[model samples]
Target chain A: MTPALELSSIEGGYEPGLPILRGASLAVAPGEIVALLGPNGAGKSTLVKAAAGLVPIWSGQVFLNGRDITRTPAHRMVQEGLGFVPQTENIFANLSVLENLQLAAALVPKDRRGELSKMFALFPDLERLRKLPAGRLSGGQRQMLAVARALVASPSVLMLDEPSAGLSPKLIGVVFERLQAVREAGVTILLVEQNVKAALAIADRAAVLVEGRERLVGAAADLAQDPRLAGLYLGAGLEAA
Target chain B: MLQLLADGLVVGSVIALGAVGLTLTYSILRFANFGQGEFLTWGAYLAVTALGFVVAVTGGGVMQPIGPFSFGWELLVAMVIAAALTAGLALLVDWLLFQRLRARGAAITLVIASFGAALALRNLLQFLYGTLPEYYTREIQIAIRLVPRDVLGGLRITPDQLLVIGMTGAVVLGLHLLLTRTTLGRAMRATAMNPALARVAGVDVAAVIRATWIIGAALAAVAGVFAGLVGQIRPGLGFELLLPLFAAAILGGIGSVWGAVLGGFIVGLAESFSVPIFGAEYRAATAFLVLIAILLLRPNGLFGEKP
Candidate 1:
């Protein structure tokens, strides 16, 4: 299948010549969830930021469904079916929960607005908290709000950075289960996750990043059992475990 | 003591009007505009010019008599003209300066630029209208009795003071109702909380900004006109009022309407009481003193939220 989000020879960061990504490139096929497993500070965030057009790519090009969008603004990119749910500080704290969803819908067309109800259906708590301020939400509820915000745009590709961060064990199960439902709904998902086992279980394919470079790329279960991965990163962390 | 209260209420009304403008812009625009007081001055000066036109057209000699009410309709005419003129100027200021600054992500720079705009506008008024003081021709003001003489010490009043207090009360009540019970006001409040989020929710920020300028400038003009009628009118009428006007706004809280209204009367009473304790020259100094006290006691003004 043709890749939905194609990144080739992509290099970017906050400044010129001093790139954080270091020639990083990857792709996500339509109706597939690709887990990008990496250690902390392995340029995972940098790659996602660049793909979302928040940071300029210094050298390489980015394509969305075969169309070039190397210079689009982050808001406009949301309209073109590329959704980014950042790690933190994503939703406006003072705005109402319903307002947060409506804001996401601003990037979408009016005709496609029936999906808004479908969005609220996915997050029952947010529907209940629709008139209440977003600041009143719990950490788990807030993450769900952020995720629901991006998904409301009905994007073809959704990039989530560490969806399970700062959540309880029970909340983590609920979040991953919702993500599974999202993947089943046929949107391409490119995830940056630290939970290797949970991510690999849902992912069709995976890319292993170590120190700002793609160390290995393979089928999800194959890399999960790879001897090199087992010895280098996970195996090392697991040895103590 | 009674005369001071009466005079204080009249001046307090002007402050309340001016403070409404200051606070409205502060809430909607989310910035402390140091230049609004000068707009009040400009509004007064414009009122005189509007009065001149009214006289030339009707040959009624500038200050028209208010039929048997012991008041002047000339001041009434000036107020309307002043409100219209200042509202237009306010719109122009946003179109050229503040709006572009907002679009370019220059919040602090826009605040500073409003000061520059204020200085330029103030100087332009000074150049056009010289330093001489003027006022509407004096008419017999029939006092509305509230208390008889020799009741605790003494209680006296004037029709002008009663009129001023009456008008100020009406405007405040009207504005309070408008803010509490309007769709546009609700949208304006939401925009103030977060502009980006407001845009995402499909609120037209430009329309809201325009309305803000109009309301702010109109309130300033109302204060300016009344001040001219009660006190001596001058080219620096608005400039002189700025310190106390802004003091009221800060005391009320940066973005709270109720806070601004309460702050206005508190300031009026303070200025009145201070004149006996500190002398007439120190009247304006009270604004600065209040600022220092607020900084030490309540930095967000009485109405502002906890930092």
Candidate 2:
């Protein structure tokens, strides 16, 4: 079966000559949850951004459902069935919760704007605070609002960058549970996470990267038992293993 | 005191019209457009040109005063034409000059480019119409006394002053509706707050920018026409008012629409009241004084959020 999102040997970074992602390859099948794990400066976020067209891929192809979308602008990617939630400032802080949903819905066809109710159903907490500004919400609530906003676009592939960051441990559990529910709903998810154990619990597959190269890719359960994960993540001579 | 208020309202109306445009553009464009004042001059000139054409077409016949108004229906028609023409010119200026500079993402360059645009537009007006001041109508209507000379120290207001105030109120109300009730307005506010998020959400950022220019120039045109009706229109007409317009925009919190209106009234009253203490020659100075004080005390202006 064709994957929902595929990044093939992607070479990209912030600057033209400085490449943070070098020959990074990852594929997420439809209805699958893939957690991208790596330490700081491991280019995990860069790979996700490149897939979402936020980072410029100097040399590679990004495919969404077998169609190459390598050159699509970041703003147009949503209409093409790709939704991305950045780690920070993902929600429109100044707008009310309803306005945030309405703004995203406006991009979709008029007939499909009714999906907002589905989003509200998925995140009933957002419905309770619909009138309040997104800025006033708690950290976890804001993250939920951001995810709901992306989901309202009805993207076939949702890419989240560090969704669990800045959340309390209890809230982190809620976020992971929500991610599981989202994957169960048949939306392919590419999650960039630092919490390896929690991510593995929900992720169908996991990929580890170090210094812009993919070090390991396997089923979540297989990677969870591998003794080399610490060495691979911390750069402690994984080549010997 | 009543007469001063009456006079202040007339001046306040003009400033408010210009300030609304100025504030909106500043918030959305993220630049102080020096060329905004020229929209007023262009509007007034466009109206006068249209009036001249109308007079020539009918051999100056069928022209008659409408009640207390100095000019007839032809001037009203001309005002509409002027507003439309000025709006078009504003769009043209943005297309020809500002848009390219904006793409470079240099705030100072955009501001300097606006200054350059202002010079070109102001000079173009001067070349087309001479430097001498011109009025919409040569006829001077006497002020209507609301209170007799014996009552309230001879309080009175002219028809033109009343019309200016009425138009300002209508425009302000219309703007309030546009900003609060419409989807386009919500998009505009969203764009102003976070352009990146707005764009990703599928707002046509370019369309919003174009709409902003149209609204800004349209309101400024009305202010220009009123300026001519109340006093006189000259090449330097908008230039002289530009400083006061900026003062009002800053005093109103730089981005808030209602703040701009309130700031305009405050500035107008300050100017009018200063006449008794510092003479009419220092009227403009009072506007700046109030602006400086507001900046020092409340850097964000009254309606501005803590940014």
Best by DockQ: 2
lDDT of 1 at B93: 83
lDDT of 1 at A50: 86
lDDT of 2 by residue, A27-71 (tens): 999999999998889999888878776678999899999999997
The residue ranges of model 2 lying beyond 4 angstroms of the native Cα positions read: A236-241, B54-67, B73-76, B148-154
lDDT of each: 0.78, 0.87
Model 1 chain A: ten consecutive residues of lowest lDDT: A232-241
TM-score of each: 0.73, 0.92
Model 2 lDDT, residue A152, Cα: 81
| Candidate 2 residue-wise lDDT, B215-300, digit = tens | 99999999999889888998888888788898899998998999999998888888888888899999989888999999999999
Clashes of each: 2, 0
Candidate 2 docking band? acceptable
